[model samples]
Target: MKIFLATGNKNKIEEIKKIFSMENTEILSIKDGIDIPEVVEDGNTFEENSKKKALEIAKFTNMITIADDSGICVEALNGAPGVYSARYAGEHATDEENNKKLIANLQGIENRKAKFVCVITLAKPTGETYSFTGEVHGEIIDEPRGEYGFGYDPYFYIEEYGQTTAEMKDLKNQISHRARALAELKKNIDEILK
Candidate 1:
């Protein structure tokens, strides 16, 4: 089973591959001659964005496509940076910029609770689509640490692990938000593949 994934994020591609490698499903990126369209994620919800991207790509390639839209939502900030996590600081800001802004926004604030959220959409060429969501509850730290992971991982601390996502590089496969989402995806794929 070779499914087309509508994304250019190498990190996401790698993560998905690692989880689904045993499923015997070849997850091919849109860059692999699929010519998938760049769908604008103007939706207010993660599910909307995910399904939009998946359906957009499926329309072009006429193949099964998977798309994900994820972000970090801060509880103290009223679930802020939720759908706009990618462009939180600015539309053109870098990951470092976004992280810095997030930290600064919480300066002097006691409650630093937050969570990482992911929504994945799977679409068939015939227009059928399904969605799944994953979330990892945690808090935001004042300082960054570790060299692994990207985005706000350095400051997103997991209560169960007692370490930031970046700091828990060795254990990311079992605790990260993406990992949780992938776990769900793998379960569904297993039933389908079998």
Candidate 2:
């Protein structure tokens, strides 16, 4: 079976591909000449956005489509940048821009408590859907670190791992929020497909 991954982010594609390395399904992306309008992600929550993207893409492709919404939620920021992680700095913000804004916003604040969250949704052309959510608790550092991973991974410090998500490539793949959500989805793939 072929599945459509409703995203244009190559970084996310690579990570998700790793999780599904053993699967027999072929994962297709928007970069494969599949023309579609840009998805407007104005939902209030991750699940909402995931559902919106999955359903829309599934309908457009008439195939099983999987979409995930992920972001970093800081306790002190009252979960701000939760759904707007991609554009935290601006409408067309880059990772570095968003990180800089986050640092500026939290300057002089001692509370670094934060968490990364991911909600993955699977949708069929029939409109039926399944969603899974996962989170990784950690602290945010003043400056970014590491060169691996994407988004806020460079600044997300996992105390237990004693390194940022970007710093621990192998560990992040196993314990990150997106990884956990993908793991859950994999565990129930049969039911979801059935």
lDDT of each: 0.83, 0.91
What is the per-residue lDDT of model 2 for residues 68-89, given as tens digits with 9 covering 90 to 100?
A: 9999999999998999999999
lDDT agreement of model 1 with the native? 0.83
**Cα-based RMSD of candidate 2:** 1.0
Worst 10 residues of 2 by lDDT: 16-25
- Per residue, candidate 1 scores C-alpha lDDT tens digits across 51-163 of 99999888888778888999999988999999999899998888999999999999888999999999888888778788778899999998887888888989988878788
Tell me model 2's lDDT, rounded to 2 decimals. Answer: 0.91
Report clash pairs, candidate 1.
none
Task: Mark the regions of model 1 whose C-alpha exceeds 4 Å error after superposition.
Answer: 30-33, 190-194
Per-candidate clashes come to 0, 0
Each model's TM-score, in the order given?
A: 0.92, 0.97
